[model samples]
Target chain A: MPLDIPLIGARTALWLVAQIHLFLAAFVLGAPIFIVISEWLGLQTRDPRYERLARETMKVVAIAYSLTAVFGVLFAFVLMGPYQLLTNYLFRALYPVWALYGLFILLETVCMYLYWYTWGPLSATTVRKWMHIGIGVVLNVLGTIVMLLMNAVAGFMNTPPKAIETATLWELVNNAAWWPLNLHRFLGNITFGGFVVALFAAFMFLTSRTGEDRKFYDWMGYIGNLIGVGALMTMPLAGYVLAKELFLYDAQLATFMMADKLSGYFVMQGLLVVLLFLGANFYMWLSMQRIEGGPRFAPHMKAVFGVLLAGGVIWVVPQNFFPDLLSKAPPGVSEQALILPERFAFLGLMVAKALAVTAIIIMTFVTYLLYRRARATGRIVWGRIDPMAQYVLIFIPAVAVYLMGLMGAIRSLTRMDYHVYGALKDLTPYWYVVTLGHSSVMAAITTVSFFLLLVFVFWVGFVMGKAHE
Target chain B: MSDPGTDPREARIEAVPLTPGAKGGWRRVKGPGIFALAGLAAIWVLLPMVSDSWGIRFGAPYRVFFSLAVLGSALFFILLNWGPIPAPGSPLTTFASIFLVYGATVGGVMSFGLWYYPQFEIPKPAVEQARAQERGKQAFLSPAANCFACHSIEALGIRGGTRGPDLSAVGAQAEARKSGTPAEDYIRESIVNPAACLTPLPASGLAECLPAADPARTYPPLMPPGFKDRLSDEQINDLVTFLMGLKGLAEQDGKSR
Candidate 1:
């Protein structure tokens, strides 16, 4: 039976709730990694600033943790209510996995709270600090298990193992796409967390009254961006391996993604990636300006920026203008006419796009190298950067969130008209590959709504901190 | 008197006070704004002409224009703001920055919606053989027969698996494989019983084909032979018809023996 909720329909409602849940969940999972690192650095260097940064970020994560759970519960309710058939089928197949996931969630929650609430008491002695870091390590492991447990379910939906009825739990959990999806999401979480931390720091830097506070926030933002961009640098390789696995599993499904139904979505993804590259490089360049020796390399950096821009343009070129195979050619246009001419066809091939992406990555790495060299030679005046740099920091996370939304949609929709791919078909009335336009609109809505809810989470954290003060 | 928590390097660094109004007020904004507008104008004027020259319309070029314009504007902004100018840190400016980036992303995606994938209205074949060939193509792609899993017809744009031979010129090539056998009979035999007559190995050897019976023998009988039971009689006939239609460019040019 088709379930319909009043205003937005069941699928849209589920999409909004699920996306918000995922955004917060990613942040909470991702933030703890850097938090633990900062805490460890503090212990090593005895630098109180690292300790302060870790604690301040943990405060945000603590409040956001509750919101993540709230949204997660809401996501479950939405799933069970409207997508009952799929939910029931998945539950029946992986009941033990689901139970294990729940157990891990509970363990992770406890570890997170213990790590947060014991910060003051644990920091007094070096032994206690090590013990505290131990709790954080445990929290990350538990969180990773939770994410991997769910990744199996998602991976199975797209590429289920053969003879699923007779397949063992291990076979089912280790589907063709499982490990790649885990690696991709593992890297994605860190990148998402890092950018979000930068987002928080950017907000603080812009509003900070004292030079000391501005200086600290500015330094924090740089560290956050560094982690985010560092992970981002390796994402293309992970994504490529994931795509190769998908293609090997089913060529037709891969064609449907790259050449037919979801091709335009990849173009949109390219645009966002270009924006991310530009924003990251621009921030690095602006960051260098605060270093006394940075001005000397401006000419080299400008050429690097130009190459990055050109490669981004090449990366987004399409083989054909048609949205998908189903749509008809316009009048006076042959099927051949709809496609790019043979001479330029190479530009749209996988080889060309891969090369372009490789070039962009190299250029970005070069930019980072230049920034580091400049920093080593000259003193960096933190908090002296233009406000525009902070804005760019904010911009990276927004694009990252939107990119995540679009990618999530692509992964789910790649099953095409099926709920569990070849095993179970989606026979509902709404079983079709959604239009790119509709998917884009949904992505935009979720991205904007996630940022708004994030603002609320930040405000609540501030209010609660003040109350305790 | 030094606090161990503070970085010692931080204390020695001198504060360079920012000259917020050094470049003058409105002049800073004016330069980048003009550059952005000019870039947009250049794209608007040049893209259509370039697209027309390439025999393209309403697709890749328009998206390229959108991407270039956004990137160009971003480049200009970065260039203009490379140094500390009078740009003040305000909540309003912050919100505007976010809105601008978000708006551009959303707009770039929606711009592709202007054109839909084109559908061609080709005339149906009047012959029964042609109709069967169409059905055969569908069966080739279907999971039941899954002929496409091991064979490829590059001419038809079907990039099937590399486990078997390239079937692009199979219709013409099959006739010469066995001395007296007809092309249709050879194809049918190959489908129903793949090991009946193995194609000779290329210079590179039978690595791409199924494992051969003898180590140094001809190509292996890689094609599965149980399709006679899997598909119905009519489906098999249709599939044969489709395979027969896959004549290579030589046959299309009427140069085949």
Candidate 2:
């Protein structure tokens, strides 16, 4: 049966809703990873600071979790009308997993609400607070399971095994690329959740007037940034492994992805990775001002900054080895010359990019080490950093949001007229290749729009807090 | 129950004297903060000047400049906002300033990048077997016309599976498959209207082979039909060229049908 929809294009609508939904989903999935840790830290140390941070984080998570569901339900109905056949097939294969996912969500929600509400009463004693931490552990487990179940469906589409006779439920669950995708998204969600929470901490830091409040947010922001950057540091390796799995599944498909029309996107992804590292480290540099002994380690910033600068530049070099139709040689030069001939042109290759990214990660870890040392040995120099540092805090999340959107766009479009890689082609009238310029513009708009919407969500949370008070 | 907010310890600390360093912290932030704000305002004003730069036929150096401009602006903010000050204004102002700064810098820079960067034009190549082969490779693997999905070309490390038997020798096989079917027509027909052709059995959907009987007859044709309408003539020909170059297994060693 022919499926047709009027007024709105199915692909565009689905893509728009899906991108927004994924961002929310990432937050919901990732927030609990840190929330549980925070709760555990609070329990072990008997520190009210950790306890307060966990409680506060849960408030934001509750709002995001609710919106995630709303968007997820909306996405399902929106796609159901236009992609009936594809939806039915996936539903048939994934109904069991879907049911499990729903069950896990229900459990997670119950645990989250209970964990948040019971904190004051249940934490009257050390034994009771440990119970609360256990509840948090349950909530986190349920959330991770839900994400895993969904990734099974997503992974199946990209790398369906050929042996139909052997395609049992277990085999389907263990699709060629399922584990790699699961690992990637698992780390990705943590990274996303940490950044969003950091975004909140930054917001609070900017608005804080009281010395105590500033100190609280400053520490909270450090923790959030720490978790996020730590997770982010490992993501490149996870992503590379996922890409390798894709290549092993279908060499031709992988080649088309890395070397053809989509080549420029890898260049773009490289740029985002570099930006992420820089943003994380710069925030660290700003953070040092709040510690008295931080200046002694301050001299180390120059070296760290140098590595980041050199590494970032090397990471984004366009390695365009394959004959990409989308990328052209500079005037008066051959395409080969654009990639080669230059002394440092080899940095464009994966090996060089890997080395650069690894070096950046190591240097950033050293920066973290110094921050810890400052906290240990130095006087508490709270409220010492410039007020503009708040803008830097604001800038990090903005760049992160932009990178997320850009990366999503690159991932979705690199499929290039396929709904499920090679299994199902997109046969719509709009199945033409989108120009790199057009794709980047769409990504930028989505990023900006999502950031604006997020601010609204944060504002809504703020209003809710006021109303409760 | 005791109220923590009404604690005597907290009340006593609230009356503690502020050190000179603590007092100066709030005062030092205003100048740099205002300077940064002014710089951002200037950038907002300069945005329009760059927005009208769409038609310029600049080269890579200009692209580099634009990229560096974005990186520089961000670093510029970091430098300007380097020290702490007493939190000024409300959360709303901070929010507004961030959005404003984002729009002026990242948004403006990206907008310029989008406008200035040239879109790729389709390649026009002189008739060469190598070029056709390359085009064919792209089409064969393209998610849009994924010929690699159903056919294995071991030479390319694409194990499309026994779903269509190995297409490694399809180049030699198609030419000799049926009467009145040339290699080109055979490959095109097979893609555009697969059910109408003789599809190999175990590859299609046959579970078990029958003794002394044709296996191709046991299974229904498996390939999705109607590629004629989906793909252009050029894409089809390119795919055909790719398939024809497969030539068979490595063990065949230059043998042709």
Candidate 3:
């Protein structure tokens, strides 16, 4: 259908709603998984701290979960309004899957409320708490199922299977890009969830008035970072699989993503990943100062950081640094300046980036192992964590949000003019491929807006809960 | 002002019974019911009028359903959370609430279908596609793509090079080259990766074929490998879509042979 909306153009509206919805959805999906895990850990260890953390986090989940549904509904509207015909085509092809997704959403909502509201009542006894944990598990399972169904739809759009017009539902959902995206997003959600949780903990830690408050928040922040970094470490492997599949599905699309016009995004992606690892490792290193024998691992930190720095530099090097090789140079004096050889530029290639990122991933794990050793060898000195560490917690989530937004834009925009890859062309007035600078700017704005909105949500929840108290 | 020993949250929890009476249950359901009904009514009545007034083109009914679905889900959650729904929450009501949301969503979608039944048609022709493909063909000839600079299309009769394979029937050849590779994909790959999977000689000899080996070692890789660098993503897609249409010439040649 030809789209002509009066005020906000269809594409811009969809882009905003879709990104916001995804961020909220990721929070909803992630919060449940962590809440359940934390609950199980508490039960296993008999630590009241874990139990309290789980309870408090679930409260956040209940609030965020409602917002997720709210944004999801908005996203659906945005999809139908501007991109009706394309939506119809996909709807007809995958309506059964969509129906199942709706069913799971319903189940997830029910389970989320039950899990939240019944925390005390359901866990009155050890036997009952196990059952409560079981319910929490059910909530996460249903949430994941919903996410998978949605991923299949999104995956189909990016790498639409051949003859999608006549493809069966099974074939449609099983498109080349589906499983890779599923795996990536599955792990990615947990990582996203951890950062947001850590961000929450950091805010609490910074604002805490008492020693008890400070200590509790510090512990919570540490746990959040632990889960977040653990998940973040494996992300590169999942990313590689997705990128490889993208290349296999369509070289042109892959080339655009990695080697050409959109290459800058990949570079940005590399930098963000490096930052995530650095932030996580740096936080761990700072935490070591609180442990008696933590100083022993300090020397090794230099080597790991060196590797990470080298990798980060290599990974983010733009593939095409000399876009204007000759003509755009100063009219007279470019011969000597342009003499830098092509062989040195080879480091900017995909292979080099891959190698560098792999090195970063390994070093990150080494740093984690060092942190583990420090904990084993010496008692945690505890209390009086540097304030800068709290800022790192804040930085981690902000960068995570920004990185997610940028990646989402890259994924959708790679479709270019096609509503579905290579078919169902986007015939709207706003079908032009957005420039990299423009896309990057929009991504930054979406990210900042998301953070602002998330803070507002937390504030509202805090005020409302205070009123109830 | 507050009791030091008493926790307000626990006090509130203890104040509400875990199970409510029949009347209380109905009251809880009523809160969400009113919200859902109000939203459904707005969607049913006001959406079309809004679409008209603002002149929002394209699928107003569908858009209305979507708007309704979002509002209904949100309202359902808010009501479930805040309204006098059961004490501590009920599984039975939770199940029912789920169905309620699903029913509303399904009804919203189906109602849009009912309202705009005439708009639903099968097999709408993609007329704009032809023009896009035509532009793509021009791009192939233009200096940006320069497909004709080295590779010739016998069907179009612009044989200018012996460097690359003849693309006269590259479309059909592309499909037949790999068992499952689509013509569009094969064509796209060839543009972006000139040497990889070079087309084999058609057993029927209807078109010029590559050496099936190193055109790279012999020539200076004349098939400029990075069209992705030069052409916009849309342009590349158009070029691929255009090349996929080259199957006709191969079919005609096979028939002639």
* Best candidate (score: DockQ): 2
What is the DockQ for all candidates, taken in turn?
Answer: 0.09, 0.10, 0.01
Distance from true location, Cα of B221 in model 2, Å: 31
Query: Model 3, B101-181: lDDT tens per residue?
Result: 323423332332233212211211333455466677778888877777677777656676766666766666676665566
Worst 10 residues of 1 chain A by lDDT: A1-10
Off by over 4 Å in 2: A1-8, A320-337, B1-87, B90-92, B102-117, B120-257
The CAPRI classification for model 2 reads as incorrect
How much is A279 displaced in model 2, in angstroms?
1.4
Top model by lDDT, which number?
1
- How displaced is residue A204 in candidate 1, in Å? 1.0
Residue-by-residue lDDT tens digits, candidate 1, B62-176: 5455546555655555454546644445767755665676566555544543333322222123234545776888899999999888888886678999767788878767767
lDDT of 3 by residue, A102-125 (tens): 888888888888888889898889
Chain A superposition TM-score, candidate 2: 0.92
The residue-by-residue lDDT of candidate 2 on A28-123, one tens digit each, is 778888887887776666656677778888888887777777778878876687666567667776688878888888887888788778878987
Model 2 residue B77 distance off true place after TM-score fit, in angstroms = 9.6
Q: State the weakest 10-residue window (summed lDDT) of model 3 chain A.
A: A321-330
Candidate 3 docking: what grade?
A: incorrect
lDDT of 3 at B57: 26
Which digits, one per residue and each the tens of the lDDT, describe model 1 over residues A1-469?
2254656656788888999899999999999998998899888888777898899899989989998999899899988886777888789888889999999999999999999999999989999999999999999999999999999999999998867879988888899999999999999999999999998888777666578877788888988998999999888899888988999999988898898888887877877787788889999888876777777988888789879987987787677777777776767757765566656678789899999989999999999999878766776787778777787787898889989999999998899867888777653434567777677778888888888777676657753454587
